[model samples]
Target: MSMNVQNCPRCGKLFVKGFAETCPACVKDIEAQYVACADYLRQNRKCDLQELHEETEVPMRQIIRFIREGRISIADSPNLTYPCEVCGNPIREHTMCDSCRQRLVRDVNQMMDEGKNNANAEKDAHHFRITDRLKDRH
Candidate 1:
């Protein structure tokens, strides 16, 4: 018998076995989320499904199903505020799409790198003073 190798759809890891779609890492992550959700419910007694989804990194739909199945309790209060899906930043008025958030993060990181390089060059040139007392000494 011959086994076929396929790349996992989730993590892109190559596997030669059953036709599981996701990679081992992604499977482990899902299991971890299940355990974490269970643990959170047990410890906290009750929590909003949205909050558990955010904290455990689980999907809201899955959490809702878990609640329906008695795996977790649904709080009577309003749903928890989840961060923007893209940048993990708190979303206020407008919904920030994932693509936009990722782009913003990339841009911010690039800007930060540029600023760091500029600061290093300035430091090498002694453009900034560290101590006010040393100004007269130089």
Candidate 2:
């Protein structure tokens, strides 16, 4: 597959972007952490962030990041909760909660309405003068 050249957020090295956001070195490290976390989850099934970090030797931040990115979900493990990207509200599924999503929709609609209104106002205020030759036409 074709890959875009992108800077690795973790190491600041440029590489061909693929499935993972980080570079190959960082991806390997992340994969190892994921494996450790998954192995612990297999046995514990439902555990809190602190417990998972202690048991698996994976950082709590990475685990939370995984959840937020949808790499790891809480469908079966309902105990996990990540902050909403917009309002910081705890959510189960996507990045933002229902309220934030609705708010974003409203904000976008309001901006669109403002743009339409501005365009109509400009159209209504437009001025033009007919040339003498045009005015002389019967």
Candidate 3:
């Protein structure tokens, strides 16, 4: 029931925001490109990004997007790799390498632990000054 108006990234047309990003026309075009890329990959399992882009005529950005979105995978092509978002190491899957992922997990866990400790400390310093006053009066 809620409507949001935003400019489409593909054609720059203002449109009611929907599940998919691009407007209807652009969606069709992107779908066509995805199909073409998928077909090309099926035939050429060992292809790299450059060769895939050259052969399929799909943009490298879109191809990378497909990998990020999990629509495409590079397991069969061992040489294929994408830069990690954190350390820029070459990674075959996900945005980060294993070390970066583990580090992030540890950092987040430490933050959560600190938050819980703070909350517990606050609870213990604790309170009920008004309750004590009422009890004394009674």
Computed on alpha carbons, the lDDT of every model, listed in order, comes to 0.65, 0.82, 0.86
Give per-model TM-scores: 0.41, 0.70, 0.67
Residue 99, candidate 3: alpha-carbon lDDT:
100
Worst 10 residues of 2 by lDDT: 124-133
Q: Which candidate order results from sorting by lDDT in descending order?
A: 3, 2, 1
The alpha-carbon deviation from the true structure for residue 18 of candidate 3, after best TM-score superposition, in angstroms, is: 4.8
lDDT of 2 by residue, 1-138 (tens): 766999999889999888888999999999999888777777777787778888888877899888777777677776767678789877778789999999899999999999999998888668444764588885
lDDT of 2: 0.82
Write the candidate numbers in order of decreasing TM-score.
2, 3, 1
On TM-score, the leading prediction is 2
Candidate with the larger TM-score of 1 and 2? 2
Candidate 1, which segments miss by more than 4 Å at Cα? Answer: 61-138
Q: For residue 73, what is the lDDT in candidate 3?
A: 73
lDDT value, candidate 1, whole model:
0.65
Poorest 10 consecutive residues of model 3 by lDDT?
73-82
TM-score of candidate 3 on Cα atoms, chains taken together = 0.67
